[model samples]
Target chain A: SSFQNIVETSYGKGDKVSPFNVATSYNNFYEFGYGKSDPKDRSSSLKTAPWTISVEGEAERTGVFDLDDIINESVLEERIYRLRCVEAWSMVIPWVGVSLASVLKRFQPTSKAKYVYFETLYDPKQMPGQLGGGLDWPYREGLRIDEAMNPLAFLAVGMYGSILPNQNGAPVRLVLPWKYGFKSIKSIVKIRFVETMPETTWSMLAPSEYGFYANVNPSVDHPRWSQQQERRLPGGVLFPNVIETKMFNGYEEEVASLYAGMDLKRFY
Target chain B: MGQYFPDPGKLLMRLSGIWASVFVVAVMAMTLIGKIESLRFVNRYRRFIGLAAFFYSLLHFIIYLILFAGLSWTWIASDLIEKPYIYVGVLALVIMAILAVTSTKPMMRKLGKRWKPLHRFMYLAAIAILAHLWWQVKDDVSLAVYFSILLTPLLISKIPTLPVYKHFFKKI
Candidate 1:
C-alpha cells in the first residue's frame, strides 16, 4: 500500500539514493536469513496486517496499540538518510515516517524512563531464520532517552513513497541514521521505556566487536575489520565506489553533542 | 548463480574459497581412504584434485585482489597490517602455487625422493587455510567448525604411531 500524505523533506537531497531494487534486495534482516538476498527471497511469508505493538515499562498509557492507530496520529514525512552498516557498506534511503519522539511522547513516559528498548517480532513460522541459532531470537535494540528524542531518530513506516517491503522491515522500523544500520531494528513488536540501559542484541552477542553506542566513527575499527572506509552500494567489481567514512556517518554536526564530555573511544 | 547474487564479486569470492577448502580437504581424505582395495583407484586422481584446489585458491586470491581491494597496492598493504588473516590466506595461496608448479611429470621425476618431503608441505598449507577460515570470522563460527570437523581426522591420520591409524590401515 502506498502512503497518502508523505511530505518530502530536504534530508538527503544532494546525496545519490541507492537503486530501489538494490536497496530492497540487499538487506541484513537476519530474521529472514543471513545471506544478503535471503530476506528478499524468504520474507514473503511474513504477515504484516493487523500488527500491534506492545508498549511497556515506565509509560503512563502503556498497552497494546494497533499499528494503524499510531501511524494515523502522526504526519508522515519523507526523510532521505544515509544508512551505514557496521560491515562497511552504505546506502542512501528515503524513509517516510514521523519522529520517534512524537510517537513515544503520546505514551507519556515517566521521569524514570531513561532508555527506550525495541524488539523485532519472533515467530518462527513467519520468520524462518529464527529457527537457526544465528542470534538470540527477538532481535532487540535500544537508545538512551536523549538519543531517542533526537530529531535524527525516526520511526519509519514506509520508504520510497510506499509502505515498506516485507524484507525491508514492513509496517514499522526504526531509522537511526547516525548509528550503524543494525541499530535501526526492523519489524518491531515491543517498545519499553525503562530506567536502566537496555541490552542490545549485537552488543550482547559480541561486546568487543559491537558496542552499544554504534555511532559510525571511522576512528573506531571493529576488532576484525576497518571502519575507516565504506563501499557505497551499486558498486561494481572494477569500480568499487570506496569512499572515506565520515565521523558519525556525516551526522556529527547534529549528533556530536549527544556524546559530549563522554569518552567516545571508551563508549565505542 | 551469478544472476541471483546482488554482489557477484562477493558471491564468487565465497564460492571459490569454499571450493578450494573442499578440494584441499578431499585430497587429505583420499590419502587415508585410498588404503582400501576398492578405493585404492582414487589415489590416481589425487593430483587432479590437488590442482583443482590450487585453481580455486588462485581464483579466490584474484577476486580478493581485484574486486575486494580494487587492485590498490596501498589498500592491500594497509590490510596486511590491519587484518592478520590475510597473511595466513596469502601463505596458503603461495604454498598451493608452488605445489601446482611442481605437479608436472618432469618435475616429479627430477625431484624423486625429495618430492615426497616437499609435497608434505600441503599439510602446512591446509593448516594455514584453516587459520585463515577461523581468524576472519565476525560472528558465526559454524563454517570454520564444520571444516575443522572434516579436517581433524585426516590430520590425526598423519601420525604413524597412533594406534587408531594402525588399526584402520591394518585391514588394507
Candidate 2:
C-alpha cells in the first residue's frame, strides 16, 4: 500500500517513497550488528521509552529535554525525502519531523559554534556490536553548522505516518538528504555545537577512504567502489534498476551554493 | 537458507570470502607448520582445504548470480562493464575452478614435478580472491585487510632472496 499524508516538498515532489519494509529491514546499523538484516532482528533489544536527548556546547541554552516533549513541542509532518547511502543504495522516505534548523534555533547556538555533532546511544547490553570494540561506540557524525541548518536537514520523529521502528532509529534520527546515509546518524542521543570540525565514525575508521564532509558526489568515487551509480532500494535487486547517482543526490540546485568556492574532491 | 540465515547474500559473501582465505592459510601452514615440531601432521589436510575453498567460491558466484544478477546471463554480461569488481571476481573464480579440478592425486601423479608448479597457482588464486573482496568494500575492510596481512608473510617468504635484504628475509 502507498503512504498517505505526505508533506510534499519541492525536493521530493514526484519521487515514490521506498516501501516501509525495505526502509526498515535493509539497514546498516552496526550498533545492532553488521549484517543488513541484523538490525531488524536484533534491534528489539533497544528500549525506546523515556528517551532523552542532550543539546549542549557553544549554545546559549544547554539542557536535557524529554524526547516526548521535543515531539509535542514541534510540528510533525510527513516529508518525503531521498536518502542515498554511501554503499551506493538509495531510498525515498516519508519522514515525519520538523527541520533541524528549527530544532537548533530553539537551542540557540552562539557564534563560536562552527560544527554540529551527533551521537548515538551506546550500551553493549542492548547494542551487542559495542562488545566487539570494532568501532568506537556511541557512533558519531557531524557537519558544518550551515549544513546542519540547511532546510533539507531534518530531525525525524516518525515515518509512514507512525512512530519510528526500533531498527530505523526509533525515538529520533538525523536526515541529511544531500549527504550520504552514514552522516544521518541513527538513534541519536546527543547533539553538540562545537568550534572545530568533529571527526565522524566512518572517517575516523578509515580516513584514507571516508572523508569528513561526505556529501554525495558521484565524481569522488570511494577507493573501493564507484559512487556513480546506486541500486534504488525496495525491489531494486529484482528489477536490477541501477541508476546514475546525481551530484548531492540530485539536490545540487538547492545545495550547490553551500560549497560554491570549496573544492569538493579535497573536502571529500 | 534455514530459518536462521537472516540475509543470504551477505552471509554467502562472508562465508565464501573466508573460504578463499582459509585455502591460502592452509597452504602456507602446510609449509610453515612443518618447521614447528608436533604440528607436522596438519600438512596432510592442505589439499582438502584448497578444494573446500574452491567449492565455497563457486557457491558464492552462484548466489551472486541468483540474488544480485537475477541469474540472467545478459545481466552478468553487462555487469562485467558496470561493476569493475566483476572482472577480478570472474577471473578468480575461473582460476579457482582450474585448481580444484587439478587437485586429484591421479592428476598429480601423472604430472610429477610439473604438478607442484601448476598447483602454485593457489597463491595467484588467493591474491585474486582478496582483490575481489577488497575492491567491493565500501568503508570497513578490516576483514579483507586481515586476510591480506595473513598472506603477507607467506608472500614475502616466496620472494627470491636478495643479497642486501638477506638479513631480514633470512627468517622468512
Candidate 3:
C-alpha cells in the first residue's frame, strides 16, 4: 500500500540515498534470523496485518491503539536519514514517517516520564529467530524523554513512499537518525513512559560493549572493533568506500545540546 | 552477479572464512574416525582435506588484504593493533602453511620418529582458530559454540594413554 500526503522535507538533502534494494534487503532484524539475508528469506511467515501498539505507564491514554488509527492521526513526511549500524556499515534511507514527539504528545505523558521504552513483537511462532538463544527475546530499546522529543526522532511506518517490507520493520518502527541503528527498535508492540532507565536488549546482553545511549560517536570504539570508519553501502569489491565516522553521525548541531555537560564516553 | 551478490566482497570473505574452518574440522574428524576398521579408507583423503583448508585460509587472507584493506599497508597496520583476532587468525594460517609445505612423502619418510610430533601441531592450529572465532564475536556466540561442540570429542581422543578410547574402540 502507498502512503498519501507524504510531505517532502529537506532533512537529508545533498546526501545520496542508498539503493532501495540494498536498504531493504540488507537488514539487521534479528527477529527473523542472524544472517543479513535471513530476514528477507524467512520473514514471509510473519503476519503484519491488524497490528496494534499498546501504550502504558505515565501516560493519560494507556490502551492498545490500532496501527491504522495512529497513522491516520498524524501527517506523514519523507525524511532521508543516514542509518549507521553498530557493525560499521552505513546506509542512507528515504523513510516516510512523522515525528515521534507528535505521537507521544497525544498519549499525554505525565511530568514523571523521564524515559521512553519500546518493545518489539515477541511471538516465537511469528518470529522464528526468537527460538534461538541469541538475545533476550522481545528486542527492547529506550531513549531519554528529551531525545525522543528531538526533531530527528521518527516513527517510520513506510519507506520509499510505500508500505514497509516485513524484514524492514513492517507496520511500525522507531528511527532515531543520530543513534546507532539498533537503538531504533523494529516492529514495535509496546511503548511505555517510565521514570528510570529501561534495560535495552543489546546493552543487557553485553553491558561492556553496548550502552544505553548508543550515540554515534566516532571517538568511542567498541570493545572489539574501531568505530573510526564505516563502509558505505554499495561498496565495490576492490574499493570498500570506507569513510571516517562523524560525531553524532553528523547531527551534532541538532542533538549535541541534548547531552549538554554530560560526559558522552561515560554514558556510552 | 549483482542480483545474486549485493555485496560480493563481504559474501566472498565470509564464504572463504567459513569454508576454511569447515575443511579444518573435516580433516580432524576424519583422522579420529579413521581409527575404526570400517572407516580406515577415510585416512587416504585426510592430506587432501588439510591442503584444501590451507588454500581456503590463503584465499580468506588475500581477500582481506586486497578487497577489505584495499592493499593499504596503513590500514593493515591499524587492523593489527585494533583487532587482536586478526593476529590469532594469522597464527592459525601460518601453522597450516607450515604443515602443508612439510606434507610430502620424502619429508615424512626422512623424519620418521619426529613426523608424528610435528603434525600434532594441527591441534594447536585448531585451538587458535577457535580463539579467533570466539574473541571477535559481537553478540551471537552460537556459531562458535557449534564449532566448539563439534571439536570437543576429536580433541578428547588426542589425549595419550586415555583408557576410555581403548575401551570404547575394543567394542567397536
Model 3 local distance difference test score? 0.87
The sequence of per-residue lDDT tens digits that candidate 2 reaches over residues B49-147 is 777777777877876666544445544555676666777888877887887788888988888988877776766776776777687775457777888
Best by DockQ, which number?
3
Question: Where does model 1 sit among the CAPRI classes?
Answer: acceptable
What C-alpha lDDT do the candidate models reach, one value each?
A: 0.87, 0.78, 0.87
- Total backbone collisions for each predicted model: 0, 0, 0
lDDT of 1 by residue, B1-172 (tens): 2123336666678888999999999988887889999989999999999999999999999987777656656556667787778889999989999999999999999999889778878888988988999997765687799899998788766866344667867767
Report model 1's TM-score to 2 decimal places: 0.92
Question: Candidates sorted by DockQ, descending order?
Answer: 3, 1, 2
lDDT tens digits, residue span A75-135, model 3: 8999999999998888899999889998999999999999999999999999999998889
For candidate 3 chain A, which ten residues in a row score worst on lDDT?
A234-243
Better of 1 and 3 by DockQ: 3
Error at A265, model 1, angstroms: 1.8
Residue lDDT tens for model 1, A105-215: 999999999999999999999999999896998899999999999999999999999899999998899999999999999999999999999999999988988888999
Please give, for every candidate in the order listed, the TM-score of chain B alone compared with the true chain B.
0.87, 0.79, 0.87
Cα lDDT tens digits, model 3, B1-172, are 3334556667788789889999999999998889999999999999999999999999999988776655656557666787878888999999999899889889899889888878888988998888988998876787788889887778777865244566776666
